[model samples]
Target chain A: MPSRDEIFEKVKTTLVDALGLDEDEVNGSSRLKADLGAESIDFLDIVFRLEKNFGIKIPRNELFPESLFTADSGFAENGRVTDKGIAELRTRLPHADKDTIEALAKDPRIENVEDLFTVNMVVNFLTAKLNG
Target chain B: MRWFWIDRFTEFKSGSHATAIKNVTLAEEHLHDHLPGFPVMPASLMLEGMAQTGGILLGESNQFAHIVILAKVPKMTFHSWACPGDSLLYSAKLIQQSDEGGMVEVKAHVGERLVAEGEIVFAHVDDAANGGAKIDQKNFVFQILRNVMDVGKAGNGTGA
Candidate 1:
């Protein structure tokens, strides 16, 4: 099994190669949108890279916050998710529920791109698949 | 036949890399029939644009040794929607190259926002051997692509 740092580096390289970004822009905290200026198409590129690099299949809906991640039940409005914000998404899986997603999104522990919970989910999934 | 999109080759370096552009407009006939109220360029067509770009690169690079046909799209993902009046810039770089086949990484964008991305794989085939006959370069395939794309020019008489 590869170390966490090794996996992280591989993911970062995939991002850089796919997005045509410089080394400085790819870091632990770089947000796909805000920090790296990744547009929608770029997001897809990242997903493609992730899938190819890790050899894992991430559902299309799982990639977007609007599709799967949501806030609390009471916080939801008219079947819409309200923002309590996610605190730390590291523990939450890509298919996790609204409250869990909210906690992770609000969590400061996910400060950079490397800190995203989805990456961990992907890594774990890939590791398990490869090991078995 | 009118091409759904048209782009100019801004940068072309023999076989290593290439860049092109596609202008989307409401005037396109496909848009009218694609969706009634919501008209957006089809993702498959966007991929075709990438393929064309990569194909030209491969043809030029290999000196037209084999006609490059898009064999497989391992993965493709779209992040945003592209509508009328959007100019998509496509750039492709050769990743792996050989006598028989190659792969290129391609990305499309509107302004600074990325719209779609995928890796295109191409297989090299002899025009006469595969098609069971010899083919002309200018008046055959390149001419057709030029006519469809309305680019009006061929790439150094190589894309037969």
Candidate 2:
């Protein structure tokens, strides 16, 4: 199994190619959307690149869950994610930064939840997938 | 005048790869105005041809169950260009797939010359939109694009 740093380096390259960012522009703290300007389509591109690069199956919505709190998801209401939604997020996204998710937990607004998915979370997810 | 970019699928392998051909002709109106004296096939249309070739491959992989939308082109490079009378060949390989979508690596070539190559990302849109609009991917795919796929049944690649 590759070490975490090796996985992070590969993931960095993947993000740079997927989002058209410079090598220096990305780091562990870079937010996929807020910092890298990733749209919904970009996530699919990222997942494709990561899967090809790392040779692992990163299931859809496993790394970057979208519409988790949609109107009919039973996890949100009036744009606010319910407590049940937050807990489910925690379970699904265990690799995400704890502090980042906690911040969202405090706010619990559906829009703010995307901020919790950072570069570190990707590294963590890959590390666990490869090393687990 | 029809929006069909690819003439026919030259090859296909469900959930694997497919190749199609496009016969660029000066008779097409767009080429006449794109560059008055130089009636070369636009790289954009070539890219679209690649997308259609790749899209059909992905759609067939799932038996056309999901509406495969070309979501993004993360990487594309034009090594050369095609012109009137050139039979451009587009080869697409399914690189990755999930319930959400699939990715394909596509390349355009004429004879032995590489015209263009790119990676296209496709997303499977749900049947119904939030506001009640709906599209049946299988039906729509068959209506406009099924002829090219039929080539797979009679020609080079595996059965559809």
Which candidate gets the maximum DockQ versus the true structure? 2
Question: For model 2 chain A, where is the 10-residue window of minimal lDDT?
Answer: A64-73
Model 2, B1-160: lDDT tens digits are 5568999887778899999999999899999997889888999999989999999899888887777878899899999888898999999999999888889999999999998998999888765532456764545543477667665445455553
Determine which window of 10 residues in candidate 1 chain A has minimal summed lDDT: A108-117
- Most accurate candidate by lDDT: 2
Task: Name the weakest run of 10 consecutive residues (lDDT summed) in model 1 chain B.
Answer: B140-149
Cα distance off (Å), candidate 1, residue A109:
60
Model 2 RMSD in angstroms? 3.4
Each model's C-alpha lDDT? Answer: 0.63, 0.86
State what share of the real interface contacts each candidate retains. 0.00, 0.94
TM-score of chain B taken alone, candidate 2? 0.87
Q: What is candidate 1's lDDT per residue for A59-88, written digit by digit as tens?
A: 654544332333333334444333432322
Q: TM-score each candidate.
A: 0.49, 0.91
